[model samples]
Target: MDENRKIIQVLIAICSLFFIIVGYLTYIQLFRSRDFMANTYNRRQYKIEENTSRGNIYDRNGVLLAYSKLEGEEQERIYPYGALYSQVIGYSSKVYGKSQIEAAYNNELLGIDDLSQVFGMVSGSNYPTRKGNNLYLTIDHKLQALGGELLNGRKGAVVAMDPKTGEILALVSSPNFDPGAKKLEENWQSMVESEDAPFLCRAAQGLYAPGSTFKILITAAAIENGMENEVFEDNGSIIIDEREIRNSESKAYGKIDLKKALALSSNVVYAHLGTELGMGSFMDITNRTGFEKEIPFDIPMSKSRFPYESMDKTDLAEAAIGQGKVLVTPLHMAMITSGVANGGIMMEPVLVKSIAHAEGKSNKELKADKLGRIMESDVAEKIRVMMQEVVASGTGHNAAIKGISVAGKTGTAENELSVKKKAKEHSWFVGFAPAEDPKIAVAVIVEYGGSGSEAAVPIAKRIMSQYLSQ
Candidate 1:
């Protein structure tokens, strides 16, 4: 009887301990962290006044991207370029609080981290919410402005980056709202409610079917998985599982090599390649390049997905050509270009250059982090030569810049959402300039645009020119 009583007591103690642990874990995970980190009421009471100049945002070369001005008589701040840099430097309205860099770097900008010193004059407040920190971004203002010009009145996105350094130079999204226009529209309620969603940064947030541009990733994968003596002889059409996959425009090419196949962006040839490597092999390649995952970046970025278990042989062929069940954002495409340029190394994309402190001192300088190596050096070199040929003699001929050995691939992917009708195409271009020693890698996508070469390449040209000139 005594032994049974002891066992009961032990069981009771164990149950009580388990309950205590689960309760503590729940409190820590759900409530304790939020209680310590967030003070919404205190934040509202000490909100930065509208009249004070919000901190300014500048490009690496000291070009101003966003600035705040005080209204006449009243101290309320006004945004002159309104929606121009909205995503990068978020709005600081009394009603809207903040977003983007405004919210991310708010502590540094407002000097909240620096607690007001005794010697500091003015209102002599102890918790002096200092003026927002000045930001020096990796963006090139000229490139961003020109990119915006190219995307003007369109519905798409452009992303340009320094391939060697993972520095993002230009990020533009069309159907851009004139920040000033939002304030004057007396029907502001209706404007915000519109379907266009002008407030969102399509370049960073919008996910689209990458189309043929994804072929670049496939090519990298094919070579990585052994193609030593294997050749993709382009006889114009390839038959897989009784499905006839033809080249774009159904053009005929007799007995060309894999290099030429990639140069010409042949769906028939890559479809064969995809089947040869199989779905498992394709997923393996994408995993190395940061696909099917979320990457750590200061800015919000969309994740790339390739969700398919087993597809029809025809779908597999199409998927190999970058057409089926694959969606990507412009930012993700930029990373792919960077991987090719950096010798198959995928570097984490960086927007902020450095963070400065309240007392005019620079704090931590952010460095480019190596995500992972995606291919063998030999494989990367092979893909590089193939991409080079794409510019020198293939569909991407329009992307060539004199003295700069540009390498690029163009993609005209049809939107399957409207599959029954003559599908509206998404124009895409991914390239790196000064190919031998790549400086800039760019990705551009134009929705409902005709051809990638015709619609997207010229915009890249302007950006490359302005960047090299600078």
Candidate 2:
């Protein structure tokens, strides 16, 4: 009787274990498998069709920038001015997938958990989908158009911002790719696999040494730290460790005033100033100016990081001239100038202004948020005066616009390491107008342009003049 009882107990235990395993397997196959399958398929088909109508993007003036239209039961996304806004409004596709603005606002535009209702004509009746809202951006269509025209086949980017609101008015990336062209099956593969990688948005992703334009930040740091003396000097080239450093063109402006050094973009003075300030001060300033941070905007933004690790005297000197370990995106440079123009306040840079459903109901409104105060108003004032002098009699004189207080700095960076043929240089300009109570701040970059004055400054002048007129 005892052996029989043991056998019965063993059978019951085996049955219980088998039932438990079966139940768990059922859960895994039914629930977990579906999620995994969805995730796997999302890259190819799920991102657009399932969640939401990819949001319609609009300019500040309510001009349609990007939108999706249904034709013959197929919804197609389109860009009216394809290449002009490619980087800012990244292309959405199955192969290239989504990037930049498309990925940034994918949730809102595709109506994933969106609270607003989207009404659509379905089967001779109106159907409401909680997703599918339109995104209104701060970009001005006319300004963006003009910026592209101004680029004129140059390999570079243009960024314009409202100093007060941190609203980007124009964001143009050159060598633009047409989203419409990619719509064709034959052209898609060629465009994506091309050598240029027109798919890569240069405005936010490309980083380069900013050259003399970096003097703006260095000068601001010097003035803020109370080291703004015309008599300050170092060995003309400070060899902190074992590296030999020399000023640009290997020329020095001996015993010049702080303002004069800024105008000439004297490498010697700024390098010495950077050494005095050290990495701690440099990091602090960049952090405050939003350089060492990510922009919290509706569109995707590349984080701006300044590498300070392994800093020797040589690297620091190079970094002082916006070279060496230091690299910045054009967007980052624009934010720095925007901070200076906004009276030391760093406003969160944004591309999209607001979002709404097809029924015209407001969904998500993009309000400009204050990031932080980077510098004191008084310090900004002093730098403003210096920058004004930069345009009046400095390297940036070419960027001078008539009847406007145009304060700007020019930069010419050598690109010996660039993969492009010719090993061309980079030109950079960052400035704001009406130096007093400024409204617009701009940053322009021309790749392999030879000189900042020769190639980059005129574009800035044209944009600033247009903004001032408006």
Candidate 3:
């Protein structure tokens, strides 16, 4: 009887263990399968690639940017424009895996439907004729080429977008690498180790002090706080916490209103205004404007930085003048500029305009995503007028185009590497063209580039001119 009872207990334990294993397997197949398939380190993607003919990537004008071709039983992914679209299209390699749009839409590119993925995995079926879907981007090839040309050899970025539709027109980051190079495998190690960091997408990922380009947001904050008409004294410099804040070249502008202050890019005036608005007001504006938050983008983006909690008045003063702890991406700056251009409504940027199957059937058509109003339309208008003054008669004079009304702000951000080592300031220009009804907004930054007016403004002007003329 004791032996029979022991045997029954062992049988019950075995049945329970079997049921538990079956349940766990079912959960993994239903819930965790996609995660497993999407893992870069997973060997299943390579298996899928074996049977799938990867799709091509095209610009808004149908200009071929990237495609795959079979050569002697081996498939080679080719980028026609080479390094020009490197950081944007990114690279898809069996060895190094994928990145950017290539990684973001890998499943679509491989034409792996849910059912097909499961079927292939379960049955080990061979599908040699499977073709991936093509991606149509919002990028304009001409604008992208022009931006690349302007930023070539520089360590910076340029981001241009349509204000109304949130469509990215051109995104350029310099110090790029050719992903389709013949010796890519051999050069990959050195490229990764290089100080230039050619793989880093400065437009979306690089963070830098926005300089006076940030003054646009500060100006909007002032208007929202009912301080738009307030006058302030600017005698080149002001003392806060025993530290003196000086204007560019320590030039004084005497007593000035917000408009003149912004037009002149007066650090002293803005610093004073920053103190007057207080930390609560400052934080409120930054929060509403997408600072210190994830900006929804097709590709990966670094969140623009702003202090989450109130610090010392000195820190606040420095931040108000676009210095100290504040940092931003070129893409975010462009989006902010677009918000001002789009009547205060910040639009979420779109990259992939559409996706089409191998049969040329449209799979999806993307639409504009509104992030809601960052400020009142009237407040944006007030800031727009100030920006116009900036381009017309102020530091951004070089950005003005003949027969076109341009509104812009110039920023020369201090780039100090340490307490002793000081690098040249980063040059920045953010603005929109035909001010009254803006078609395009742009942000340009030049690393170690001196004077936003001298280094960044002209690049922005040319981009706006080219896009508007189209």
The true-versus-predicted C-alpha distance at residue 333 of model 3, in Å, is 0.7
* Higher-scoring candidate on lDDT, 1 or 2: 2
Clashes of each: 6, 2, 0
* C-alpha RMSD of each candidate structure in angstroms: 5.2, 5.6, 2.9
lDDT of model 3, residue 136: 95
* Model 2 stretches with alpha carbons more than 4 Å out: 1-55, 94-96, 112-131, 181-184, 232-252, 417-422
lDDT of 2 by residue, 326-387 (tens): 77888888888888888888788888888888676877777788888888888888888889
Question: Which is better, 2 or 3, measured by TM-score?
Answer: 3
Residues 69-144, model 1: lDDT tens digits: 5445333434445566666665654455556776666555544431232222234332323465677789887787
Q: What's the distance in Å from true for residue 4, model 1?
A: 26
When summed lDDT is taken over every stretch of 10 residues in candidate 2, the lowest stretch is: 114-123
Model 2 scores what on Cα lDDT?
Answer: 0.76
Residue 196, candidate 2: Cα error in Å is 2.4
Best lDDT goes to which candidate? Answer: 3
| Top-TM-score candidate index | 3
Candidate 3: count of backbone clashes, pairs at least 3 residues apart or interchain: 0
What is the overall TM-score of model 1 with all chains considered together?
A: 0.85
| Candidate 3 Cα deviation (angstroms), residue 440 | 0.8
Which of the two, 1 or 2, has more TM-score?
A: 1
